[model samples]
Target: MGDDLPPDLARLRVLETWAAHYLTRIRARIAAVERQQAQQQTPAPTAAPPSRPGTGPGRARTPDWGLAEAGIGVPTTEIHRGDCWARGKTLVPVSAERARAELADGTQPCAVCRPDRVLNRLGSS
Candidate 1:
């Protein structure tokens, strides 16, 4: 019985040693992965430039020359690039022909860009 106990104890010690080695290897692999992730991380932008007006997310500074209908069901109006003062309005892009047609259909051209002048140029050309 004493002899059997020594063999069992030896086996238990071997298992413990194997588990420790496995755990050490796992920890080393995890550390290596963490270091790699850190190296791959992009550095934060240094001294971001001052944001321009109307340049925030989902806001267009220079929108395409087109007709814009207010998302809140306002009448569709001719809008020029960079001239819309109405915030939270979704502007849909249209062609010059469409702009002219829209104006003829009672859609007002943007007072700022004067898209009517563009329509006149298109007519002359």
Candidate 2:
């Protein structure tokens, strides 16, 4: 075949072969990079065991009256600093004095923290 072909045609054939080989390698590298990027974007699976009560990661701290709120001002239930076991409730931090006043105005204390007793002690002096 090389004997039948002109030199320029032979040279062109060789260049085309080289170009095809180079393009194939480039495409493979692009695919590898895309795969890497996809792996990076995927979220890792969380295989951590469920947290144990008062002993594992993210255990609930003891509830305190350091901060108080009335469940976003609806007065349904008051909240203190720690977890209240109430769902879908928002807390608005207030001063201890304001918390006492809210308690006086019939806002129920948080069942978890018992802010009523805490405020009573605060009011005592």
Q: lDDT of all the models against the reference?
A: 0.61, 0.58
In candidate 2, position 20 carries an lDDT of 50
Best-fitting candidate, scored by TM-score: 1
Off by over 4 Å in 1: 1-63, 71-76, 82-88
Clashing residue pairs found in predicted model 1: none
Question: Cα deviation in Å at residue 62, candidate 2?
Answer: 13
lDDT for model 1 comes to 0.61
The TM-score, computed over Cα atoms with residue i paired to residue i, of candidate 1 is: 0.39
Lowest summed lDDT across 10 adjacent residues in model 2 is found at 81-90
lDDT of 1 by residue, 1-125 (tens): 55543467688677666765565466567767877997999867869875665587996665546566643333344555534443124567676677777778877776546778877688778
Poorest 10 consecutive residues by lDDT, candidate 1:
80-89
The runs of at least 3 residues in candidate 2 whose Cα sits more than 4 Å from the true structure, single-residue gaps closed, are 1-75, 82-89
TM-score of model 2 (CA atoms): 0.36
Sum up the clashes in candidate 1. 0
Model 2, 1-125: lDDT tens digits are: 66754579788667666765565466567767877987889656779864443455564534334344433323355546444333123456566787787777877676555777767887898
Scored against the true structure, residue 91 in model 2 reaches a CA lDDT of 53
